[model samples]
Target: MSYEKRPDGRNFDELRPIEAKVGVIKNAVGSASFKIGKTWALAAVYGPRELHPKFLQDPAKGRLRCNYNMMPFSGTGDRIRPGGNRRAKEISMVTEKSLMPVLDLKNYPNTVVDVFIELPQTDAGSRCAGICAASMALADAGFVMKDLVSAVAVGRVDDKIVVDLDYQEEAYEDGPVADIPIAMLPRTKEVTLLQMDGEISKEQMAEALELAKKSVDEIYEFQKKALKEKYTGEQNE
Candidate 1:
C-alpha cells in the first residue's frame, strides 16, 4: 500500500503552518519561540560570558553550547523521562553544529554562549524546531552571525516525497519511510546539517534536497520576520 494522500492533506511540498516570535523569555539574554503545527520550541540564549573551566577557554574564539530538552509530557506518544537522555544528547549536539556555521565568536574570546531549547509540546519535528528557535535567539542576543539557519524535515513518506513531515508520516507503516532533517543557510543555500533516518535512493535524495531547500526559504522568511518585528516594535504572531 503506497502512501498517496498525506494524513493532514498538505500538498507534497507544503509545510505545516508556522508561528514565530522573539523576546519571549524575560530574564534570558535573548529568547525566541517557534511553533509548527503541534510542535513548539522555546530557546533562550545566555552569555558570551566567561567559560568556567580554565582549560576549556579558547583564546581566539568563544564556544557555543546547546542543550535540548523535551518535557516529560511534551510528546504525542509515550511520556519522556525527565532529565538528559541519549536522544536529547544527540539532538543537542546536532543542534549546536547546525547553528555554528553562521556564527562568528572570535571577538568574544574565552567566553561561552549557551543556548537552551525546551519543547513543551511536540508532534515530531522537535529537533528542527529547536534549531530554528535557537538561531533566532542567538541573533536576538546580538551575536555576530553570517546568516540565520532555518531547518525542516523533508523525505520520502512511502511513495511520495514530502516536506515538513508530521508524526503520522514518520510512523507510516504501509511502506518505506525516510525522514531527513536538514538545516541550511537560506541566503547561501549551504547545508549545515543533514541527517537521514531511513534508506533513500540517490534520485530520491536529490529530490528531497530540492524540496528541503525550497521549504527552508519559506521558513527563513518567517525567521526574518520575527526578528524584524522584535526590533521594529511590530507585534508578531
Candidate 2:
C-alpha cells in the first residue's frame, strides 16, 4: 500500500504541535524544555567556567560540550538502556556541533560550556528535540549567540515525503524510509548539522532539505517565545 497521508494526519509539509519554555530548571544557569508531539527533551546549561585539566583548555575560544541521554522508559519502541551508550554519545557530539556556529565563545576563552539534554519521553525525533532544547537553554544562559538553532527530521516514509516523522513512520516496513535530521541557524539559514539514515535520491534529498529549512522557522519562533516568556515573567513580577 502506498503511503498517501501521514499516520498522524499531518500534511506532508506540516510539523507536529510544539511547546517550549525556558528556565524550567531553577538550579541550572540555564534550562529549557522542548516538546514536539510525544517527544520531550529537557536541557540544562552550565559553565563558561574555567576548564579543568589545563591541557584540554582552548586558548583561542571556549569549548562546547553536550551530553544527551534518554531515560530507560522514554521510547515508545523499546526500553532504552540507562547511562551512556554509543547512540547517546553520537547525538551529544552532533548536538554540540549543531549549536556551535551561533555561539560566541571567544570571550570566554579557556573555559567550557556544557549543555545536558535528557529525554524523558520520545515517539521518535529524539535527537532533534534534544538539539532544539539545548539551543534554547544556551540562549537562556545569556550567552552571546548570533541566532537560535532549530532542528527537525524530514524524511520519506514509503513513497511519501513528510516532515517530522514519528515512531510509526520510522518503523514503516512496506517501502523505503529515509530519515534526515537537520539543524540550522535562524538568521542566516545556514545548515549547521545534517545527517541521513536510509536511502534517498539526490533530488529527494534536496527537496527534504528545503522542507527542513522551512519547517525550522516554526521551531525557532517557539524558542524565541520561550525565552521571551522567561524575561516577561520576571518583569511582571
Candidate 3:
C-alpha cells in the first residue's frame, strides 16, 4: 500500500485530475461516476427502502450496507477475477465505516440505504475514490447528513511526505514506504477515516495528517461543484 520514498517528479501536494458526474444512472435513486487520474469508480444509491433481511434491519434507524467491486479487466496486462472477493468486501466495510458517522440514519426509520461502488478501472487508491463518490451518491439519494465527506491519501515518498499518491508513485517499492489514507467531514473538520500501512514515526504521521486535512478541502470543493453541476446547471435547475 506504500510507495517508495522517491521524489518521482510529482509535486508533493498535487492531486491527480478528478472528474465527477452525478445522476449517471437514471434508475438509481442517486448515482455518480468519479475518476482520479486513471482510476475510475461508479457509485449508485438505492433506498430508504424496506429491509428484506431481518437480521440486518434496525427499528430505530435506517441501516446501511455497501458493496464494492473491481471488474476483472480493471487492471492492465493481466485480468483479475470477477465477483465479490474478500478484498472487495473488506473495502466495502471500511468505506461503510467512514460514511457511517455522518448519516442521520434515525430519520428514516425501518428503512435501509444501499450503496454500491464499482471500479471499472483502477491504478491505486480506488477505495479513497470510492469514499468520495459514495458520499455524493448518498446526497443524491436525498439522505440526511451532518456534512459531506471528502477523502484523499497521503504517503511518504523519497523520505518526504506527499499527498495524493498516483499509481506509479504508489507502486514504487524500493524500501519501506507508508500509505495513510484520510477522510473527513469538511464542515465540522472531523476526520472519519484514517488508515496507515507500513511504519512511520509519530512526527511523520502528524505531517501526513496535516497534509491530508488540507487536501481534503480541495476534494470537498470538487464534490460541491459536481453536485451543483448536476442539480444547478442551466438546464438542470
Largest lDDT belongs to which candidate?
1
Top TM-score model: 1
lDDT of 1: 0.94
lDDT of 2: 0.91
Better of 2 and 3 by TM-score: 2
lDDT of each: 0.94, 0.91, 0.85
Per-model TM against the reference? 0.97, 0.96, 0.92
- Shift of residue 144 alpha carbon in model 1, Å: 0.6
List runs of model 2 lying over 4 Å from the truth. 234-237
Clashes of each: 0, 0, 4
Candidate 1 lDDT by residue in tens digits, 1-237: 777799998899999999999999989999999999999999999998999888999999999999999999998779999999999999999999999889999999999999999999999899999999999999999988999999999999887899999999999888899999999999999999999998799999999999999999999999999999987877743
Residues 95-116 of candidate 2: C-alpha lDDT, one tens digit per residue: 9989998999999889999899
Candidate 2 structure, TM-score to reference: 0.96
Task: Put down candidate 3 lDDT per residue, 9-32, tens digits, no spaces.
Answer: 557878888888888888999988
- Write down the RMSD of all candidates, one decimal each: 1.3, 1.6, 2.7
TM-score attained by model 3: 0.92
Ten contiguous residues with the weakest lDDT in model 1:
228-237
